[model samples]
Structure formats: C-alpha cells, structure tokens
Target: MRRMYFIFLMLCSGLALAQPRIQLSPPQAVVDSVFFTETTTVRLELDYPGVALRYTLDGSPVGSNSSVYKGPLALSQSATVSAKAFHPDFEDSPQVSIAVRSLKYNQPLSITNATPKPAPQYTGAGLSALTDRQKGALNFAATPKAWLGWETDTLRMQLNAPEAGKVNMLVFSLLDNAGAWIMPPAVVKVYDAGEQIGQFETARPEPGGPTQYHFLEVPLKPWSSDTLEVLVLARQLPDWHDGAGRPAWIFLDEILLTQKP
Candidate 1:
C-alpha cells in the first residue's frame, strides 16, 4: 500500500510537470515608438510555442479563437493592450500598454486700417466728365481724386509711394454696383521714376460686399520712391458678353501701399 501511494504521488507530480507553461517574451510591456498614427500597431511576441495567444483591451478578454498575433497588433488610440496565452491547463500571460497621439490647418491674416498718404488731386477734366450720378457716387471726399470715370466708361487711377523699402503690402477698397465685390483679373506695374521695377498679376480678389477691401503682399527689392500704375478692366461674365449686361463698375475709396517700419 505504501509503495502504491508513493507511485500515485509521483504520477501526480509528473502530470503537473507535463502541463504547458505560458509566458510573455519581454515580461514587461514595450512599444516601438511613442508617436504614432491611429493606424499604428503594437507587437506582442510570445515566448511559448504551440500555445494559443489570447488578448484583452483595457480589462476585457479578447475572446477565444481570437487571431494569434504573429506580428504587430493594430491599435487606433492610446490604450492598454493586454494578452495572455491559453493552454489546456489555462495558463495566462501578463498584460501590456501602448500610447498614441492625434494629427491638424493654419489660417492667414486679415486686412484692416489701410489709408493713402500724400493724397491725390482730381484733374478738372476728369472731374467734369463725371455725370451727376457719378459725382453723387464719389466716396472719397478728399482731393486728387486721381481716379476718373472716362466717356468710355473706364475708370483710371494713378498712385505713388513716397517712402522706399520693399513694396510688401497693397491695400485697396472698391465699391461694386452689383452689391457684390467683383474681382477682375488685372496687372499691377511698379515703377521707380521712369524705370520699371516689378509687376504682379492680381489673381485673388477680396469677396464682394457693400465695400470690398483687398490686401496683397509682394516681395521685391527695396526702393524709396516708386509710382504704381494700376489698370483695372472689367472681365466679361462667363455666359454674358461685355456691353450686353450692366457694365462692371468699381469705385475706389483708397489704395494703401505699406512696408515694414
């Protein structure tokens, strides 16, 4: 009987030794990199072979028959990724953790406080041609209304800059008869005395409203005294020909040129 009891004890010991062992490779959790996208993944390598790997998120079991993670595991947010190994004996591995971060537009500045210096004077010929309706519509009460509405219905303005520096800024206020600011493609030429310095094509115009102000910044070599010649012509509407519809009219209240002080 003693011999039989000893044999039985030995058999139980052997069975316990035969049971599968489950362990994590690193023992402690690890992540490849801290900064990762929502699509980034974490890899949990298993140490024991032939054993099923089970996982949990937070604290919930991932479920039986869950795909064995042979490679990196996918994670969307910053959270703990825990896993365990399952064998017939129900051995389990330790849990793990991984951190993640989110991916953002930067907007530009708005134009305000634009005024013309050394104001312009309106020529009598230009002023006399204005119809009673045009004179009544004049917004700038100040003189040198260098701007004039011609018999051809074209409006012209002559401008000048007194100080030298890069012509880094251009600001203009225009009135649209359509009650909306219309940006017509136009060319702006810069001249120092009689010499041409630079030119830029106006592409983006401010949105039309009761009063539209446009601010354009150009980078050019520094200069002190320059005359700006701006010729603005109305563009035909996509489906309508010129002269068939109301003429495109823009009233200039001010044009400001500025540079870094």
Candidate 2:
C-alpha cells in the first residue's frame, strides 16, 4: 500500500511540474508619430519587473537572443520596429511591431485628372484626398470617408508639383481585407509626359488573413518633373477566393512622394 501511495505521489509531482507556464505580457511601444521628416524616436515600456525586453529594427522577428532594449531608439530611415518581453518564470510574450515612414510629409502638390474615378460611394474627399496625408484605418466600414475605392480594373491620376524636386520613391497606403474581398493593387506604373519612369508589381497574398493596412513603396530612378502620372491596376480575385474571376476591390487612402536627398 505504501509503494502504491509513493507512485501516486510521484505522478502528482510530475503533473505539477508539467503545468503550462504563464505567458508574459507584451511590451508597449510609444512613439510620437509613425511618420517623420528626418528622425524619430521609439520608446518601449513594460511595467513588469524582472523581465527583459528585446527588439529589432529591420522587421525581423524578436527572438530571446535579440538585442536587449536599453533605451529609446533613434531611427533615421524607414523601418519596422519589433519587440517582445521575456521572463524566466514565464513563456515569452507575443511579438509586437510598428512601422515608421521617413518622408517629407505634405509636400506641396496639386492632384487632378482622375480617370475611371473612384466609385461614387467611396469618392472620399475627391482628388485632393490622395495627397492629404491622412491614412485610412483598417476597418473600412468605420472610416468609409477616408478611403477612395474602385471596383474597376484601372485607376489613373495626375500629380502636379508646384516646386518640383527629384523624387526617388512613391508610397501608396492601401488596405487588404480578404474576408471583405478587398485586395491590393497588382501593378503600379509611373510616367512623366506619357513616358514610363517606374513600375512596381505587388506580390499576391495568400488566401486567408485578417484585415490590415499595407504601405506599397515604388522606387523611382531619381527623376524630377512638374507633372507626373500614376496608374494603378487591380488584381482579379484568385480561384481560392469566394469572388473568384471577378475584379477585386481596391482601396487607397493616401499617396506620398519621397524626394531624393
């Protein structure tokens, strides 16, 4: 009887040791703005003591061996900052990330000549809305007026610079919500005086994911022009999607021009 009782006690001890470890809460990142002109500072905060915070700046996953966060990070260029919290007594916290854009925000410009205009219901603030520097929320239903959507295959716009400079990049703020049947553009082409200057082909997303925002960057060959043209081509819903073979919905909130330094 005593031997049986000892075996039972050993099993109980093993069960106790096998209990799942508590998960540590993730660290919170505080920043003044996600968009900056020259430099931006990111501060990470965690209230829990005896926990170490690790971080990465190049969009890589934050591992236990990643750089320990000692202080605020001063970023001079665009990057995705990711972080996590670790404690010896707990499982590592889920990763948290934030994207920062380094660009000359609100560069003086006039937007006009939109062909195959945005759907009337989602016209947003009209042509000027593209350059308003206002990013759209992930929930299109919540901020319907912030986005200009298109059900068609093509969208073209003319951007006129009052005091033009050499532009090296074009950033398009877009939304991707597969459940809602909204997808990002397939191709983005830029032109100057009807001559193609730059082109970008976006990668196709997998079949399922939650709604999210994406910044599509198109790199140009460092050229300047008073008048520039942008063309956006919509992707057709893939066979795996519910609306297969039909034109996918496209949403655009803001367009940013990044100048060459």
Candidate with the greatest lDDT versus the true structure: 2
Off by over 4 Å in 2: 1-30, 38-52, 70-76, 85-95, 162-165, 207-210, 222-225
> Candidate 1, residue 211: CA error in Å?
7.0
Task: Judging by TM-score against the true structure, name the best candidate.
Answer: 2
User: Which 10 successive residues of model 2 have the least lDDT summed?
Assistant: 161-170
Query: What lDDT tens digits, residue by residue, belong to model 2 across residues 1-261?
Result: 999999999999999999999999878887766677789899999989899999999779999799999999998887788899999999999887767777754466667788888888898878777777666666777777779888988888888865555557778888888887899989999887778878999887786554667778887764456888989899989889989988888898878877644
lDDT of each: 0.42, 0.82
lDDT by residue (1-261, candidate 1, tens digit) is 999999999999999998877543322334553333345566665565566666654535555655566667666553456565655644454444333221101011222211221113323223222211112122333323433321222333445454446446544433333333233324445445556555556553323222322323333455555445444444332223233333343444334454422
RMSD of each: 25.7, 3.7
- For candidate 2, the C-alpha RMSD (Å) to the true structure equals 3.7
Question: What TM-score does structure 2 among the candidates reach?
Answer: 0.75
**What TM-scores do the predictions have?**
0.32, 0.75
